[model samples]
Target: MRTPNASRAALTLAALFLATLSLAALPAGVQARSSDRGKPMLINADDADHALDESQPTVLSGNVVITQGTLDIRSARADVTTRNNEPTRVVLTGSPARLKQEMDDGSPFSANASRIVYDLTSDTVTLTGNVTVNQRGNTMNGPRVVYNMKTGRVQASGTGTGSGNGRVSMRIEPKNPTPADESGND
Candidate 1:
């Protein structure tokens, strides 16, 4: 038996959990390059298997490299899913898969992990298993990291356990101050 207020509170909590799970926004002033979304994606690999059915995943292996505009990804193997012959998602695996891209402010963003999932529909990249992310001279290390390419929001988490390296860490560099005499009026 639950009171009406209790039920409402439960619903609100559930909604907040769902929101946090789906879209964790990063700090302001850190966004990926918007123009990269409009660019064509190009993939290169030593071997590929394309299924007859367009919905089936296409597998690429051996030194797989994928690029779109300033965004670049490198992995030993990749599984690409398509909708209407356009890639909807890509899962990359390697000893440690790598990704790099230029941010809107011209700073470089990079990540490395054992597995990486790039979801085109959501415009998000999820890195798992000993993940490391670097952006704007700051670094984050954790068991999992999710980056929203569109919003440039990043969410990182640990293993959620008390034992053995179940923690997340970050090193944030201090921002440099602008000089007052840069106007050059003198």
Candidate 2:
């Protein structure tokens, strides 16, 4: 389903993002003073609680959200761990969840889809499921995306053999999506 036009746009966006990653003003990786100080972590949901076992780390479930600093990870379930109780990382599980990271600078970045994983220690983020990453005005979308938070590196992909630059389609204007079939065609 790749079109020549969207392919072109994706390539252009990828190039711009690569160039921007070198600039310090972009947000996904910047660390403010508060980030090192360890801002409060917030979790919200319609229902939530934590469970831990001698066999497993603390797990929080049900529309879970965990946020600290400018990094926010959301999903149906999240396992929180502290390396020696110091909160080294959090792992989330859910279909098409999202992770949004805002930098100390004015720049911001976001990932959308299922199978998204973040490495808190390294500040690296991976998005699977038609992943899209946007920085400033540049954007790229594909089946998966890997963003290195500490390094501000981003890569998007559809397949191993697919073209590195692919066209992405969007509009400055928003429009409603087509309604699903009443019979249950999701």
Candidate 3:
């Protein structure tokens, strides 16, 4: 009971629907952070609040957690900024935002601070306000600490009190310890 033109119209609609589905299935966001490129980032939170405009930042609150590759971040609240639909920066705040990841050498790295800023463009993470970082057996504590992911470099600074009142503190364990010979041979 259908004309040839009607059949053609139905076929066209079906093809259009399938094409739309395929496009919707494509992943959102461009590759902004090279280190995290090709790695899927997952975010979990009690609530996600964001602006209607996709270009604006998204805010996650209440037991927020973000994971990408080996990098893990947890905080009470976090704000994520994206450009071109890719996350460019993330700011986390809490009693103390916590971060953990594995170094290139398989050593464990961890940090905590009142505020943490992760810059995807420069591949750096800055921890501020009572910051502490522990990597392998080395530890650093200060008011501010900056870690460069690409260079494996860390910088910590205090208020320059110079009296250890708020100075940077560090503890580095020896790579190896040798025991003294019991024989006392010459």
Candidate 4:
């Protein structure tokens, strides 16, 4: 048996732990371009099946390409879900679906996977099956990777040989070293 206050405290601690886990999963200072969300999303494909009913998904097949501001995504097929006449989610599939976007600091961010799901409402991108993500010079490889565009939180995991050994791996580069002063001032 637990008291109400104890339960509240446990909930708070759980929330804090989850937040810390998200922060620790990825390298610091990683975030998508802030203006990208405000820009209109443009999608192009060889063929599109625009559903008349709101409940039906809009399917795009054959060389699907989507772009928003500095963000770009390519896949063999994409299924888009909408709510209230606005896109809520997009699921892309291919031999390897690819995504690229500019980070907040103007650095390039990219990822590749067999399948990628972008949730607009949650501002999250989830990649599965041989997932590989790169930002700046840092790289992460795993079976699955989930990135929160709004919070810049990344969570990756693996139980398959996608990372070469059925494990998740990351290579984070050190920050750039400052140049020596040319004036020779001590």
lDDT of 3 by residue, 1-186 (tens): 333332232222222212211211112331112354246556668987665455566777899766666667678987767665556676779889876665445555667788877776887777778877666566778887676766756666786323355778887776576666889863
Candidate 4 C-alpha lDDT tens digits along 1-186? 333332232222222212222323345765667787677556667887665555777777899766778877778987767676666676778889877777778887777789877777787777788877776677888888777868877777776434455668988777785777999984
The number of the candidate with the highest lDDT is: 4
The C-alpha stretches of model 4 lying farther than 4 A from their native spots are 1-31, 34-41, 119-124, 147-153, 160-165, 177-186
Clashing pairs in 1: 26-153
Ranking by lDDT: 4, 1, 3, 2
Local accuracy of candidate 2 as per-residue lDDT tens digits, 91-174: 556775665666557456665555555555776655566555555555566666667766766665666324455444332312
The candidate, 1 or 3, that scores higher on lDDT is 1
TM-score of each: 0.64, 0.51, 0.62, 0.65
Better of 1 and 2 by TM-score: 1
Model 3: pairs clashing at backbone N, Cα or C within 3 Å: none
- Residues 1-186, candidate 1: write the lDDT tens digits: 333332232222222212222222335765667787577656667887777566567777899776768777778987767676556676779989877777788877777788877777887777788877777667888888777767857777786323356678888766685566877865
Clashes of each: 1, 8, 0, 0
Error at 18, model 3, angstroms:
39
For all predictions, the C-alpha RMSD in Å is 13.5, 15.2, 15.3, 12.5
